[model samples]
Target: MSMSEAHERRLRRATRILDIPGMIVGKAAAWLIVPMVGALVYEVIARFVFNSPTMWAYDATFMLYGALFMLGAAYTLGLDSHVRADFLFNILSPRWQGIIDGAFTLFLFFPAMYFFTVATFEYAATSWQQGERIPTSPMMPIIYPLKSVMPLTGALLFIQGISELLKSYYSIASNRRFRDEDGHP
Candidate 1:
């Protein structure tokens, strides 16, 4: 197969795998968010009507919201939907844009993610070992599942960063200059 075909195939695989986290997060959201919302509303009602507050609602919401946001990062990167400045990019050709994009992924994205993964794992492990629990009236037992999301998202980002690097490197190899948006040579 030609490099173009190979690139397309690889991109397709990457795009699909990159979406796994988002799908999982989206599904998890139904269970997590629904209850959290219900609990918050219930807690508010209890506090006002009965003069009693639910201690766990705030913590539950934090975890649910955190999971939703962190798990979506991989999907965001896959779609190239992460925030960027279009102003300067409007001036460059596509291939050049690809090259610059790859450089950033290589030097910045990969290393940063690697460190984040290590740090997250360490913290999660410690929390799990200690059997961490919320220091509140309810004293809910907090586990490491949500804590593990940090490293998992980092890993997804790392995979996506390499995929982007390969696309950029391929572009640079094909021509010193980038093609237009149409991808014509």
Candidate 2:
């Protein structure tokens, strides 16, 4: 196989593996919403009817909300659900848009996320070292693994972004949706 063919296969394989994580993240994200809403309801009921609030509810809600937001990001990006400046591009021909997508991802998306992932990893590492937890609610200890999700999501997003970048490049190069040579089209 030619180098491009080999590289394309590699990208597809990686994307397939990455998609498994994306699926898990998506499902986890969906489940988080249930607890987020439930926590709020429980907190309200506790304060009103029982005249006391659960200590951990506040912390749990906060953490759940954070996890929900962070974990859902990559899944959203993978679905192309993100909003962007597509006004001019919408007017352009599809091929031109593909070219622009490739160029923009090369110049902006990858570089920006490279730094974001690195910095988030450092921040999460510090939190882990300190054994950080929610200060306001002690019962809900800061789980270092939880904080680590920030960097993990960032990395996932970076990977998905690269996949989209690859899609854009392939669209321009082959004048088709990014797909294998087997006419998976």
Candidate 3:
């Protein structure tokens, strides 16, 4: 194979490998809806039919929803499903698109996610140290577990970003958009 062809194969391999974590984590996070829905349904039945209320249901639903949203971010990114103002972007040539995407990933996405991961790690550390609990609810569910998801989500996004950056570089070198395994650009 030519050098360029070999490099493209390497890039594609890297993309596939990096995509695995987001796929697994994202699918797992999607299942959070089950427990969240269960909590809501139980709350409704308890509050209305039985003429009683549960304190933990609200907290459970809130935390589950938050986890689902945060954890799904990297998964959505892997699918290239994030919304962007792509009117002007779509009109650009593939080389220019790669330039912009790679530049943004290098200069913007990396720095922002780095700070986000650091800050969230510290946030979760403090929460764990204090054994934090939700003060708003009577049951006072432990919040440190939920807080831990923040840093984890950041790390997931960072990993997925590496995949995207590789694709962007491939696009730059080939003067064509790099397609994922599913044939998506």
Candidate 4:
């Protein structure tokens, strides 16, 4: 293979490797919606039909929703599905786009995610250490498990961010927009 083709293959391999964790976690997290819906429906039926309410449902729904939202971020980012003000961006050349994205990822995205991971890591550790519980309901479900998802989500995003950085590198090197593994731009 030519040097360029070989380099492209390496980049593609790295991206695929980095993408796996996010894809797995994101897909698993998506299943949270099923249980969340079940909890809500159960709560509604219990409260209305039987004049009884559930304490666990409120906590369950919120925790599940939060986990789903956070966990799906890396996958969304991998798919290049995140919201952005891309009106002018869409019109830019691949090299310029790569430069802009690389700069942002290097300067803005990296720092933000780094700090987020650190903070959430500490938060989760403390929660776990304390055996924290959600005080909002008498059921008082242990919240450390839920809190742990924050750092995990951050780590997942950070991993996907590396994949993005690799794509940016490919774009900069090739002077073309990087296509995904499936050949989508």
Stretches of candidate 2 exceeding 4 Å from the true structure: 1-18, 136-140, 176-185
Ranking by lDDT: 3, 4, 2, 1
The TM-scores of all predictions, comma-separated, are 0.75, 0.79, 0.92, 0.92
Deviating ranges (above 4 Å) for candidate 4: 1-3, 180-185
The better candidate by lDDT, 1 or 4, is 4
> Could you tell me which 10 consecutive residues in candidate 3 have the lowest summed lDDT?
1-10
Candidate with more favorable, higher TM-score: 1 or 4: 4
Worst 10-residue lDDT window for candidate 2 reads 176-185
- State each model's CA lDDT, in order: 0.69, 0.76, 0.90, 0.89
TM-score-better candidate, 2 vs 4: 4
Compose the digit string of candidate 2's lDDT tens values, residues 8-63.
Answer: 67766766676666657877787998988999999999999999988878877888
Q: What is the Cα-based lDDT of residue 3 in candidate 4? A: 29
Off by over 4 Å in 3: 1-3, 180-185
Which pairs of residues have clashing backbones in candidate 4? none
Q: Report the Cα lDDT for residue 141, model 2.
A: 80
TM-score of 2: 0.79
